[model samples]
Target: MSTVVVTGGTGTAGRAVVNALVAAHHDVVVTSRSTSSVHGRVRTVRLDYGSPADLEAAFHGPDAVVHCATSFTGVRGGETELGRRVLAGARRVGCGHVVSISIVGIDRIPLPYYRAKLATEKLVENSGVPWTILRATQFHELVTRLLSGLTRPPLVLVPDIPVQPVAAEEVGARLAALAAARPAGRVPDLGGPEITTLPALARSYVAAIGRRRRVRAVRLFGSVFAGYHAGHHLAPGDATGTITYQDHLDAWVRTRR
Candidate 1:
């Protein structure tokens, strides 16, 4: 059993990664800046990203590191730099492998967040930490979250764009597998089981919650939307995920009830 550390292990993808590692019977440590109720079997540690010594200490003893910590909006001194810190810390402790999760179409999309992710990918490539990068499509939970942002009263406005959202757990499982093995550079892109319009996904989510809200598709403008509209963010060729969006909402609704 290897000691595997997951950064941002409380968030959606990070939490899923931590769970998979624990299920695999690996020694798991979660590093987070924030606190949340996590698995009892998993150990949580607070990391001072600002302190190099502390970061190096946090990096100690992990056989591998699965980097899921991220923020696209440049919050808290920019999420793009988190990769650099993680690399430095991992290198300091001589961690064998560092697996970083990234989004699909980051290279093609011009969104600020995508730009930041692309920059981080570059950092990981040159970090000299024996790294592996897995690019996956957006998560089903993220799609729901975005749709929630569009919710205005009784109507949920959704952009007219095609999306293929993979399950967070599936991506986490893949990352765990990668963490257990030697560094393999960039792997194949992972996407959802099927492609669907954003409005369709929103409608399903609204129905799952028993909400009487109408899901209306709106044509958004700008280069970001243009990229989405052109399906630059889609991975139709790699429908490697098995769980459907409906399956995701069904499980989520059960948790709420």
Candidate 2:
């Protein structure tokens, strides 16, 4: 089995990827800022992009590296710097293949986060290491969290935008498979099983939690929201994900019971 290193292994998508790689019997090494919170049979390492030694150690001697690390809450150049360090480390270790996870419509979306993701994708393309970039739509959990936070008392205000939210586990599995295969520059974008409106998603989340909240659709006046509302962020013909939003809510409700 190939030695595979997964960055950001403690995060939602990264954790699922690590589990899948371990199940496949690949020599999997996971990295995080701290290993104290990491569980399971996988090996864990501390990763800090600011420290070149840490980056070099994390990517050392890996046949393949799955880069899932991203910092959305940090400074403006955090994501770009992280991507650079990952590529540099992979190059240092002579990694054969590098698989990266990105968002669908990052090129079309004008939001700063999407722009940063797109910039990172560009880095992988020119990193000289064989790479596969998988661009997926929003995750069901992210949508649920966003809606939950927007639920102010009795009214849940949701932006009127179309979204195709995929399951993180499904995306993780896809990433693991890609990491095992030959690098294919950019694969077909993965999307949810169905196209849904944000308001519909909010209502489903409210009903799942047994919250008596009124869902109201709001038109957000911004370039970012306009792009989303125009369906630029959706993958209509590329709905590869089988799990629907309702399925996500049902599973979540079962977990809470």
Score candidate 2 by lDDT: 0.87
For candidate 1, the 10 contiguous residues with the lowest summed lDDT are 32-41
Off by over 4 Å in 2: 36-41, 73-76
Ten-residue stretch with the least lDDT total in model 2? 34-43
Model 2: per-residue lDDT, tens digit, 1-257? 67789999878899889888888888888887865343455778877777889888878888899999898843366887789888998998789999999998888878777888888999999999999999999999899889879975687778888889999989999999999999999999899999979998888888778889998998888878778888887888889899998998899889989
lDDT tens readout by residue for model 1, 223-252 = 888989998888888889999988988998
Q: What is the C-alpha lDDT of each candidate?
A: 0.86, 0.87
Instruction: Assess the local accuracy of residue 179 in candidate 1 as a C-alpha lDDT between 0 and 100.
Output: 94
Tell me the deviation in Å of residue 14 in model 2: 0.2
Candidate 2, residue 58: how far the Cα is off, in Å: 1.6
